[model samples]
Target: MANIYKILQELPNLSFEEIFLLQEKVTKEADFRSKELLKDVENTILACPQCGSKDFIKWCKYKETQRFKCKDCNSTFLPTTGSSVHWLKKPKLFLRFCVSMFSGNVCSLKTQSKEFGISPSTAFEWRHKALIALGQESPIFQGVTEMDDIWFRYSQKGRKGLKYSRKRGRSSHKGDNDFVSKVLMSKERGGELDISLIKIGRLDKSSIEQRLSGKFADTSVLVSDKHPSILSFAKSENLKHETFKSEQHGKKDIHVQTVNNLAASFKADVNHVLRGVSTKYLQNYANWFGVKEKYKGLKDKVKTIIKDCFSNNKAWDMFMNTELLYKDFILKKSKRTYRCPTVRYRKHQNWNFENAKRGTYI
Candidate 1:
């Protein structure tokens, strides 16, 4: 640090072109450190990430990354399996990309891509992939929790061959059209919050219970506006509850200002900063927002963020399964909602290689 400080002491004497050149060189040097960061990426996991079984063995190496085989599930896996960083063709840049993504100032896809020397398309995919798993690390709701429901208009932002006009922002139509995206925000007193995509249209008891059941503590008091769904949910769960009128919205300390502010900020980022995104991917964005908010005021978070991102298995399939979630959450609930292609593929794959080697099978 002192050496860098001394080096910076000469910066005042540099001309405009010299400063510009020096900045370009510095950026390259900084970005190069991500490759160095790869050495610190060790497979510290003992249990199988897929089935949580500790009875596993190192199978083999594939493309220089170690692979593991679970005896229980008889499945092969990688350290980064089901992670946001999984299947990365250029993993050397992953740490650098993550740094830029979680750097407190969320940048545009173009900006992030330009900084990392990848296309905006890759950046978009990486961002959502990370969000899918990050959304899983929500805070537990307890005590005097403030709750509210926020809505976004139905949007097929990037879908092709759309038969109707693209929906943006909240619906102007007066009643529920079964097209709005409902995000339920529950914030605890000390700021650990749970922002979740509960359902598609009108917020109701069953949907809220599905997302938040057993999440609240036994003694937790639920506070919210006089929304019938919330009221019903509280009664069904036997939780202590409180309500606020429109006139008493923010006059008292019991206000839902925390979640309200959170909703506004998230809406700003989604509806304005990104110029809107598809409702199919809105849950991912909610997860992204929750993670960023969770990391605020933390002293050290890079390791925490990386761990959370890789905590789940088959997250890539889940990200790809958003269409299914959209259909199930908004449209009809399918019998195959939980069966992603990855699982289905494994079901049909041959596990016994010895027979093939002995010419018993091709």
Candidate 2:
């Protein structure tokens, strides 16, 4: 300690010009270190995204980014090309944005835009791009799994020519006003979860069966509410099924409370955190929640998200595909609402009671 103190004391004090030079040198060293970290990320790119060729050669440099040439295709590409952040305007701010995302704070696009000085639209795009990486599907559920469907009303926000109704809750199933969208959720006990926004016209036995086929093993047990469609699904699939009446709550070993709780939490997140997200992006929001639930206890979630983001080539493709717009949220015609025959049958049965109440029955 005395020798170190003596060495420090013997060093000459720097003049203002010398201090400025030293500061510049330190800043350059810091910049170099940051570049080294980013280069490590770039090293993960092996094959050419265009031709799937492993042959790579140093093509050129552009604005401190290394460019590569594919030997087979003779195409040039940047290291960031075909990746999730491929046309990112400010690469240096990416880490900061990611840090904010994983910081367990309420990070809306508006909030992020204000904090990072980026346009709200850019923040929205970047946020979804990152979420697309996290939205990869999990392996099928196994063991005792709980399954249920959650419904969200179709939103007509920001749309023209739609009559604005003051109804703020689930609508009566009597008319077109009762239109609702569905999302199927399944969770394996102590395992992964699967949540998919259903694009089917009806949540009938046939639709449930189709979605459940090949998703469960023969040894798996299914637990769900007393929906007749679900009951029929269990019978046809020949899997052991447990049915619970949701109205009869607090029952042990017979309820789909796990998946129900998951649905509740998911809805809460959509309502509170995202502040009532549009139905167009609800699937992505659900997927983001699923991934968050999957990686709940991880200590280094930021690193994990970044690793997954880079490893997901499909997400990169989806991000780059400009034709895939948010307006095209419904992938198929099946998403359109159709009147349920069961509801029509019930309404017909209720006609007699209405006529009797009105003293119009002969």
Candidate 3:
């Protein structure tokens, strides 16, 4: 039995085929008594978030669906209750498989449904819920942050037409003229990033200011290109801001390049794997991609994270801590400092954004 447990822990990075192999192996070797014993020891202690009741029992009357019922609260719900998975129909095991498949840009939801014996709608629900949960999991990136914007077309290939073609009958229109604005922000040290959706307009003073209002009220410095939007906002707010407008300095450490590369990789993956996602869910998908990147290859990272999330399961508390994480990381470190074309915009500038500069000084 101990050997069986050890073997289960050592299961390889699971593929669709590998999952079947494990299913077969586990089923053949796992007697009802052994399975019951394992469940009794491991799964017997889930708590109800709403009522804080431990008097709960696993009731899987439907065979395919798993739910927990609490005698104390007289409530029954699936594993997704109060979670991003609240309304999902895919099994929990399959949901984990979907997360693993997100290693690259696109996931074939149709193929996944067929392969896993789940309905397409169920697969879609799992994908959507997983992506949203990923967004909910991004750590508030802190320490010397950098931000910039990049443009993206909706389709992989631009509309069917030559760039210089001059056809009289409705010349050419790129696939639906859809575009996306990517606001890419990253922290120093570990390259942890906070990627967000933006309107299809100039990433200007108001844009920077709005994002800063929530996260940068306590920021130190901000860095960017010679873009006036970032520069003027820093000036108006009396926050330290710098730029890398020169050729040599741009070669050394430009956040624009960093952000572009990140966006490009994301675009490439989306194009190849997921094909193209709907714009409505783009933010959620992008956030999911960002969190995966941030936590890539940390041994047992997902398992550890899920354990912590379950241990501290309060919605309000989770939101409060999430805000703090964002403020400390994303808000404060916009113009991260290195030393190429150095500019120290702090020290002399006042920290207040609303008040007059003199109000804080003389």
Q: For each of the candidates, give the backbone clash count.
A: 0, 0, 8
Best candidate, lDDT: 1
lDDT of 2 by residue, 240-359 (tens): 898866677557777888888989988887776766765556666776777677777787665666656654444555543322333233444245432211111222121222211121
1 or 3, greater by TM-score: 1
Candidate 1 C-alpha lDDT tens digits along 91-136: 6576667766776565678988888888887887778777676665
| The candidate that achieves the highest TM-score relative to the unseen native structure | 1
TM-score for candidate 2: 0.69
Better of 1 and 2 by TM-score: 1
Candidate order (TM-score):
1, 2, 3
lDDT of 2 at 148: 87
Between which residue pairs do clashes occur in model 2? none
TM-score, predicted candidate 3 vs. hidden true structure: 0.56
> Model-by-model lDDT, in order?
0.69, 0.65, 0.50
Q: What's the residue-level lDDT of 324 in candidate 3? A: 33
Judging by lDDT, tell me the better candidate of 1 and 3: 1
TM per model?
0.78, 0.69, 0.56
Q: Over the stretch 2-107, how does candidate 3's per-residue lDDT look in tens digits? A: 8968877777767889889879886766445333332332352467755668888877644444667888988886544544333334435543554455544456
Q: After superposition, how far is residue 272 of candidate 1 from its true place, in Å?
A: 1.3
RMSD of each: 7.9, 14.2, 15.0
